[model samples]
Target: MVGLEMNELKKIGLGLTGFGVFFLFFGVIFFFDKGLLAVGNILFVSGVMTTIGVQSSLQFFTKRGNFKGTVSFGIGFFLVIIGWPVIGMAAEAYGFIILCSGFWSTISVFMQKIPVIGWLFQRFGLNQP
Candidate 1:
């Protein structure tokens, strides 16, 4: 997204930024053996990041002029959340996040091929799409 449109980039940036934090936070949570208090902290942080990620992904879907991706993102996002306690493996729970996080990174690195959308995903590490 180096020389791409700012508006579109922003959407992708938001998703990448939010998803990055989400993964970092979730990974730490899993990497550690904490008590309920720690779980509470993860819950709080995840809640905030989830909201931000959703908003960003929504923008990308909307800007790309695709409602299906937006809807899928929403469903996938919620599934990631709802399936948490039921899942035995923390990695499995966290894997849901990787979908968006990995996708954001992948799209960023390949921005040239996908055009506007790719540029937006790449904006995550750069802090701007």
Candidate 2:
């Protein structure tokens, strides 16, 4: 019933997310080509965010998972590396956003919970709220 529907939605989200990642990978493989790499990377990230956002929202409605925004908040880090010489500053800007907001913060949160991780966070002052 409701569970089945939720599962289906989750599947759809995961599928889209996979495609988005594949698109990014494709961009990486063809790094020499500026046009394809830039366009493809942007599209892939956008698609992933959209699908995940939808899934997260649905889960939130059902009181299952909290709705984190679709934007991977920190993907810009990898994007910056991809962008630099290839796509230029614009892409790098996006990369920074992804890095500072999405990935780094999330990992930092998890790190604060583990003993060793917490120590590391304290050492680096990365656990500040």
- Which candidate tops lDDT? 2
lDDT of each: 0.47, 0.53
- Each model's total of backbone clashes: 1, 9
Model 1, stretches more than 4 Å misplaced?
Answer: 1-59, 85-129
Worst 10 residues of 2 by lDDT: 64-73
Cα error, candidate 1, residue 69 (Å): 1.4
Q: Give the TM-scores of the predictions, in the order they appear.
A: 0.28, 0.39
Give the alpha carbon lDDT tens digit for every residue of 1-129 in model 2: 644454554666566656655655665676634544456455555554455565654453334221222232233334444645344434544533544453677777787889987998899988777
Query: Candidate 1 at 57: error in angstroms?
Result: 6.9
True lDDT of residue 92, candidate 1 = 36
Clashing pairs in 2: 73-98, 73-102, 74-98, 74-99, 74-102, 75-98, 76-95, 76-98, 77-95
